[model samples]
Target: MPSSVPPFSELLANTRESAVHFEMRDDYGTNPRLEAWQRGERINWDDRESWWHPFHQTIADAVARGVAVRRARIVSEPVSEYIRWEHYATHANVMAGEDVRWLPRSQATGFLVPANDFWLFDGKLIRVHHFAGDGRHVSDELSTDPGDLKLCVSAFEEVWQRAIPHSEYTI
Candidate 1:
């Protein structure tokens, strides 16, 4: 939410038609929330009030507005612990109305994917996520280049097609 890039909710607010998130990473280290989940804390999943957070609110709002909110992650098989945590955490994302999918990296051989993670909104612009080699956050950037937009949309669609829905993917 820093720099010139807009906050994600605002971007989602402005979107129409679609908001596709394409992620390509194996390990993202750890966070306090993740550690808590790993330490045996669990969401009731049925209690909407207990886990419906602002991020989920944004996605739900978009879906209510008819914007197709989708998320696709390309990950390595025999996934990292972080990814294992993410797989569980994704239940919230799914409940919020995102059509989430997962694709193993080994099966992504013939497709093209961007070098970084990005959220392409309405296929007009993208907010790219940059990370350190060890998988720490660095910064975010916004891009509106036609070529970049095309690549992001194409890459996302290809991976999304090959990905398994969250309910179907196994660890």
Candidate 2:
């Protein structure tokens, strides 16, 4: 790990070619929205004015600057509540100009999936996220190691190839 890992926004802002994210978790613990969703609350996808937060704005800006942003998720079947919410909320990501996909865990058998979630920037740098057993975010680990980068790129590409695009995936 480096002494200093730039913030995600900075990394995305600096990206010139592409930014790819791989999420392999069924639930992200401690999220209030997930809790709300678990209680049967629905997200207002049409309320973009209020829902387009800074993160989405950053992604939108990056796309405007020609950075191809894509996200792929490897999820369990009969998806968890968190995943269901994620699926419901994916329209926002699509509207932000991100390409998103979902692949059931059963279909990811042969790929060398990384243990942690990560954002790979421009095929060179990777910001890997660590989480506690309870799904609380721990810290991010950044790396530019060739082996790590290669694994992330290969694994993500494979998952992306096998995943169903967001428009077609159903929870």
Candidate 3:
């Protein structure tokens, strides 16, 4: 984590062409919504005013500016409850103009996947998310190294190609 690294919003705002995210975890235990869902507090997907958040607005703004925003998740088969909740809530992301996809871990056999989740902006910079054993976000590592950038772009594209679109994927 660099002391001068820009915030994620700044990275997204500066991105000109694309912002692709790769999520490789099955359970993001730190998500508050996951806990809420577990306790039977469901999100009213029909009410955009209630469900939409700042991140969704950011994606919408990026898309409005002609940036192609895509998010691909690689999860284990027989997905966890958290994944199912994500799958359900992903409609909000789509509504916000993001292309979301899901790929089973078994399907990613030979691909060179990165160890951590990352957002590759315009195929140039990467913000890799570091997480603890219990799936809590620890910190983010930013890199613009050519090699790292190449790896993130290649890995995301490969995963995107093999992943099923959100509308078609089922947990």
Which residue pairs in candidate 2 collide? none
Error of 3 at 48 (Å): 1.2
lDDT per model vs. reference? 0.92, 0.90, 0.89
**Ten contiguous residues minimizing lDDT sum, candidate 3:** 1-10
Alpha-carbon runs more than 4 Å astray in model 1 = none
Candidate 2 per-residue C-alpha lDDT over 89-117 given as tens digits, one digit per residue, 9 for 90 to 100: 78888999999999999999976987899
Better of 1 and 3 by TM-score: 1
lDDT tens readout by residue for model 1, 34-129? 889888998898888988889999999999999999999999989988898999999999989999999999999987788999999999989999
lDDT at residue 126 of model 3 (Cα atoms): 90
Estimate the TM-score of every prediction.
0.96, 0.94, 0.94
Could you give candidate 3's per-residue lDDT for residues 1-171 as a string of tens digits?
454667887899999999999999987765677778778998877788988999889899999999999999999989987788889889889999999999999999997988999999988889999888888887887888998988888899999999999999977
Better of 1 and 2 by TM-score: 1
TM-score of 3: 0.94
